[model samples]
Target: MYKYDEIDQTLVDERVAQFRGQVTRRLSGALSEDEFKPLRLQNGLYLQLHAYMLRVAVPYGVLSSRQLRGLSQIACKYDRGRGHFTTRQNIQFNWIKLEEAADALADLAKVQMHAIQTSGNTIRNTTTDQFAGAAHDEIEDPRLWCEIIRQWSTFHPEFSFLPRKFKIAVTGSPNDRAAVRVHDIGLRMHKNAAGEVGFEVIVGGGLGRTPFIGKTIRDFLPKQDLLSYLEAILRVYNEFGRRDNLYKARIKILVHEIGIETMREKVEAEWLTSRDGALKLPQAAIDQIAAHFAPPAFEALPGGIAREYAEAFRTDFEFGLWARRNTAKHKQPGYSIVTVSLKKEGAAPGDASAEQMAAVADIADRYSFGEVRVTHEQNLVLPHVRQADLPAVYAALKAYDLATPNVGLVSDIIACPGLDYCALANARSIPVAQQIALRFRNWERAHDIGELKIKISGCINACGHHHVGHIGILGVDKNGEEFYQLTLGGSADENAALGDILGPALNATDAVDAIDTLVETYLRIRQAGERFLDTYRRTGLAPFKEAVYAAA
Candidate 1:
C-alpha cells in the first residue's frame, strides 16, 4: 500500500476541516439543503431513504490494517456497527447522522483515508483486480498504474465535474476478474509484438439504464502516454457528452451515438496535442510510483505444496471446501490469495460488522503483510497469505463467521441495497438475494452447479451489475407490486456479453424458483466439464427460458 506523503496528508486534513465548517454552516442556517447538496456530495455523503450514507473511498481497493481498524472504529461510533462493501471496491456506511458527517471524515483522515470523489459526477475510484500483486498470471501489477491515476485525477480541475459519474478499471491478468469491460474506461495491460507492455484502452463500457460493453479505441498505447491519452478521451467526452438529460450523460451513450471510429479519431486528434506535453510520464516518475507496489518480502519456501495444507485438505472437509472455493493461485511460490466471503447465507451480500472488520484486520496483520484488499464482487481479500498458514487463517475466519465456502457460486450473490435502503430503488434486493442464497445451502448441490454468478439490481441503475451476471435479476415496480425480470447467459469475463432476458416479470417467490429451474435445466443438459455460462452460450436462451417459464 502507498503511504500518504505530506501533500496527501495536508489535502485530506484541509478537506476535513472545510467540510466540518460546511456542516456547521448548514446547521446554523447559513447554508440551505440545496446549497449543501454539492458540497456534501463532493465529500461522499448522500441523503438516502432513511438517513445519510457516507461512501469512503478505498483507492484501488487496497487498505492497511491501521485503516481497517480506523474504519471499524468509525462504523462503531457513527454507523450502526456495520459497513457495506460496494461493487466499486469501496465501502458505504448507512444510518449516518448529518451532524457527524465531518467528524467521520476527520477520523478517516487520521488513518490516511478519505471520502473525496466518491459520490460526485467526477472521476470516481479507479479499481483493479483484488489479486493484483499476488496473482500468478498477471502481466504486471496494475495497482501502480491505478495509484498513478489516483494521484493525477483526485481534485483534477479539468474533470472535477464531468457530464456524469465516471468509472475506470484496470486488469493485468488475461482472465478479467476486475470486470474492466463494464467501466467508463477499461485498461488491460498486455505486451504487443515488440514484447513491451502497454495498455489496451477500451472506452464507453458501462452498466446503467443503458448497458454497453466498451469498444477498443486503441489496440496498444505506450506506457508513457497513458495520462495524455486518458485526458484526450475525457476531453472528447467532456466536450460532447450529453448534459441535458441525466440518463444519457455517460460516455457510453456518446460512444453509442457516434461510432467508435469517430470517437477514436477525435481522441487521437486531441492526443496529438497533449501526448508530448506535461502529461507524458517520465521513466523515473513511473519507477517512483511502481516502488510503492513492489512485491512484499516473501520467504523462500519449498516450491511445492505445503504438507500442513495438504494434510488439512485431506482431514477437514469444511476447510477443504472453503479452501477450494475461496482461494486463488498466488504468484509467490508458497503463498495464496484468500477471499473472505461476506455472502453468508441469509446475510446482506456485502455487510460486515465492525467486529468482523477488526478481526479481519488482525488476521491480515498476522498472516498477510498487514494489508487487505476489497474485491469488486463485494468480498475482502488477504492477498499474500502463505499456504502453510491456511489452517490457522481458516480457523480465525471461521470464528468470525467469515469462512463461507461460496465464492463464484449461486450463493455468492452481488446485490444492491435496494428499496430497503436506497431512495432510488423500486423493489427489495436484499431479501431476494438472501432467499436465493438460502435455497442453495446444500454444499454438494452448489459445488455441482459451479461458477454461477447471480446479480440483482433494485432498479435499472445496475449498481449490482445485474447486466453481466450469469443469471441477472432486475427488480421492477408493476402496479404497486414487486417483480423481477430475469436475464440469462450474461458474463463479465474476457468474453464480455450482456444477458438476454429469459421471460416476463415474476413475483419474488417465483423468481427464486425460476433461478432454481434454470439451474436444474443447465444441470440436465450441460456437456462434460461445461459450467453454467458455457452451457448457456452453447444452448442459448431457448432452453433456460422455456424451463423457467414452464415451471412458472
Candidate 2:
C-alpha cells in the first residue's frame, strides 16, 4: 500500500478545508442548491433521491486496517450504519447530512484518504486489478503505474473538467480481472517479443448508452512514456470531444463519430510534441514510486496446500465448498487470496455494515498483515491470508455473513442502487437483483452453473457494468412501470466483448424467471464443462432468447 507523503497530505487537507467552507456557505443561504451542486460534486458529494451520498476513493482498491477502521467509524458516526462498495472499488455512504459532510471528509483526511475526483467529469479513481501485487501471473504490479497516474492527474488543470467523466484501468495479469477493456483508457501489461513488459494502450472503451470494447490504439507503450501518451489522449479528447450535447460528450462518442483511426492520428500527433518533455517518466522516478509498493515481508513457508487446509477440506464439506469458491492462488508460497463475498442471498450486492467492515479490518490485522483489497466485482479481499489459516478466516467471515462462497456464481450478482437510491434511476435494480439471487440459492445448482456474472444497472449509466456481464440486465421505465432488458454473452476478461440483448423488456417478475429459464436452457444444451458464457458464445442468443420469451 502506498502511504501519503507531505504533498499528498497537504493537498487532501486543503481540499477538506475548502469543501468545509463551501458547505457552510450553502447552509447559510449564501449559496443555493444549484450554486453548490458543482462545488459539492467536485468533492465527491452527491444529492441522491432522498439523501446526500458521499463516495470515498480507495485508490487501486488498497486499504490498510487503520484506513478501514476510519471508514467504518465514518459510516457509523456520520451517515447510515453501512457503506456501499461501488464497482469502481470506491465506497459510498448513502445517508449523509450536508452539515456533517465536511466532518466526514476531515475524518477521512486523518487516515490519508479523501473523496477528491470521485465525481464531476474529472479522471475518477484510476483502478487496477484487486490482486495486483499478489497475483502470481502478473507481468508487473499495475498499482505502481496507477499511483503514478493518480499523482499526475490529481489536479491537472487541463483535464479538471472534461466533456464527461473519464476512467482508466490497468491489468498486469494475462487474465484481466480489472475489466480493463471497458474503460475510457485501458492499459494492459504484457511482454513484447524482446521479452520486455509494456502496456497495450486501448482507447474509447466504455459502457453507457453506447457500449464499446475499446480499440487498441497502441499495441505496446513503453512504461517510460505512459504520462506523455495519456496526456496526448486527453488533449485530443478535450479539444475534439463533443460539448454541444451531454449525451454525445464522452470520448467514446467522439471516437465513434470520428473513427478510431482519425482519433489515433490526432493523439499520435499530440504525443510527438510531448514525448520528450518533463512528463516522460525517468527510471529514477519510477523506482521512487515503485519503492512505495514493494511486496510485504513474507516468512519462508513451503509451497503447496498446507496440512491444516487439506485436513479441513477433507473433514468439513461446507468448508471445502467455501474454500473452492472464495479462495484464489497468491504469488507468495503458502498464502492465498480470500474474496469476502458481499452478495449474500437476498441482500443488496456490495454493501457492508459498519460492524462487518470492522470485523474485516480485525481479520486482516490478525491474519493478513493488516492489508485488504476491494475488488471490481464489488467484494472485499484478504489478499495475503496464509493457507494454514483458511478455516479460521472462513469462520470469522461466516460469523458476519461475509462468507458467501459464490465469488463468480449466479448468486454473486453485481448491481447498482438503482431506484432504491440513485436519482437518475428509472427503475428498481436492488429488488430485481435480490429476486434473481434468491432463485439461485441452491448451492449445487449455482456451483453447477459456473462463473456466470449477472450485472444489473438501474439505468443505462451502466454503474453496475451491465454491458460486460455474462448475463446483463438493465432496468427501464415503461409507462411509469419498471421493466428489465436482458443482454447475454457479455464478458469483462482479456477477450472482453459487449453483451447482445435478448429481445424485449420483461416485467420484474418475468425477468427473474427468465434468468432461471435462460440458465436451464444453457444447462440443457451446453457441452461438457461449458460455462454459461461459453454456451452463449457457442450457440449465440437464439436458443436462450427462444427459451426465455417462449416461457413468457
Candidate 3:
C-alpha cells in the first residue's frame, strides 16, 4: 500500500475542512438543498431514499488493517453497524446522518483515506485486479500504474467536471480479472514480441442505457508515455464529448459518434504535443511508486504438497471443498490468495457488519501480512496466506460467517443497492438477489452447477455490472410494477461479451423460477466438465430461452 506523504495528507485535510464547512452551512440553512447538491456530491455524499449515504474510496481495492479498522469504526459510530462494498472498489455507509457527513470524512482522513472522486461526473476510482501483485501469471503489478493515475486525476482542474462520469481499470494479467473491457479507459499491461512492456489502451467501453466493449485506440503504448497519452485521451473527450443531453454525455457516446479511427487520430495529434511534457513520468518516480508494492517478506517453504496441508485436505472434506473453490495459486510457491466471500446465502452481496470487518482485520494481520484486498466481484482477498495455514484461516473465517466457499458459484451474486438505497433505481435489486441466493442455498448443488455469475441491477445504469454476468438480470418498472429482464451469454473475462435478452421481461416472482428453469436446462444439456458459461456458449440461447419463457 502507498503511504501518504506530507503533500497528500495536507490535501486530504484541506478537502475535509472545506467539506465540513459546507455541511455545516447546509445544516444551518445558510445553503439550500439545491445549492449543496454539487458540494455534497464532490465529497461522496448522496441523499438516498431514506437517509444520506457516504461512499469511501478504497483505491485499487487495497486496504491495510488500520484502514479496515477505521471503516469498522465509521460503521459502528456514524451509521448503522454495516457497510456495503461496491463494484468500484468503494464502500458505502447507507444510514449516515447529513450532519455527521463531515465528521465521517475527518475520520477517514485520519487513516489516509478520503471520499473524494468516489462519485460525481469526474474521474472516479481507478481499479485493478484484486490479486495484482500476487497473481501467478501477471506481467507486472497494474496497481503501480493505477496509483499513478489516481494521483494524476484526483482533483485535476482540467477533468474535475466532465460532461459525464469517467471510469478506468487496469489489468496486468491476461485473465482479465479487472474487467478492463467495460471501463471508460481500460489499460492492459503486456509484453510485445520484442519483450518490452507497455499498455494496450482501450477506450469507449461502458455499460448503462447503452453497452459497448471498448476499442483498442493504441495497440501498444510505451510505458513511459502512459500519463501523457492518457492526458491526450481525456483532453479529446473533454473538448468534444456531448454536453447537451445527460444521456449522451459519456466519452463512449463521443467515440460511438466519431468512430475509433478519428478518435485515435485526434488523441495521437494531441499526444504529439504533450508526450515529452511535464506529464511524462521519470524513471525515478516510477521506481518510487513501484517500491511501494514490493512483495512481502516470504519464508522458504516446500514448493509442492506440504505434508500438513496434504494431510488436512485428505482428512477434512469441507476444508478441501473450500480450498478448491476459494483459493487461487500465488506467484510464490507454498502460498495462496484466498478470497473471503461476503455473499453469504440470503445476505446482501458485498456487505460486512462492523464486527465482521474487525474480525477480518484481525485475521489479515495475523495471517496475511496485515493486508486485505477488495475484488471487483464483491469479495475480499488475503493475498499472501501460506498453504499450510489454510485450515486455521478457514476456521477463523467460518467463525465470523465469512467462509461461504461459493466464490464463482451461482449464489456468489453481485447486486447493487438498487431501490433499497439508490434514488435513481426504478425497482428493488437486493431482494431479487436475496431470492436467487436462497434458491441456490445448497452448497453442494451450487458447486455442482459450477461457475455461474448472477448480477442484478435495479435499472439500466448497470451499477451491478449485470451487463457482463453469465446471467444478467436488469430490473425495470413497467407501469409501476416491478419486472426483471434477463440476458444470457455475457462474460467479463478475456472473452468479454454482452449478453442477449432472452425474451420479454418477467414479473419479479417469475424471475426466480425463470432462473431455476434456465439452470435445469443447463444441467440437462451440459457436456462433461462444462461450466454454465461454456454450456451456454456451446448450446446458444435457444434451449435456455425456450425453457424460461415456456410457461409464461
**lDDT per model, in order?**
0.95, 0.94, 0.94
Q: Model 1 over residues 229-342: C-alpha lDDT tens digits? A: 999999999999999999999999999999999999999999999999999999999999999998889999877899999999999999999999999989889999999999
**Per-residue lDDT of 1-552 in model 2, one digit per residue for the tens?**
799999999999999999999999999999999999999999999999999999999998999999999999999999778999999999999999999999999999999999999999889999999988999898899999999999999989999999999999999999999999889999999999999989999999999999989999999999999999999999999999898999889888888889989999999999999999999999999999999888888777999789999999999988999999999999999999999999999999999999999999999999999999999889999999999999999999999999988999998999999999999998998998899989999999999889899999999999989988899999999999999999998999999999998999999999999999999999999999999888888999998988998889
Clashes of each: 0, 0, 0
Q: Clashes in model 1: which pairs?
A: none
Error of 1 at 128 (Å): 0.3
Alpha-carbon runs more than 4 Å astray in model 2: none
Better of 1 and 2 by lDDT: 1
For model 3, residues 125-196, the per-residue Cα lDDT tens digits are 999999999999999999889999999999999999999999999999999999999999999999999999
lDDT of 1 at 104: 95
The TM-score between candidate 1 and the true structure equals 0.99
Q: Residue 169 deviation, candidate 3, in Å? A: 0.2
Q: Provide the lDDT at 54 for model 1.
A: 97
lDDT of 3 at 105: 93
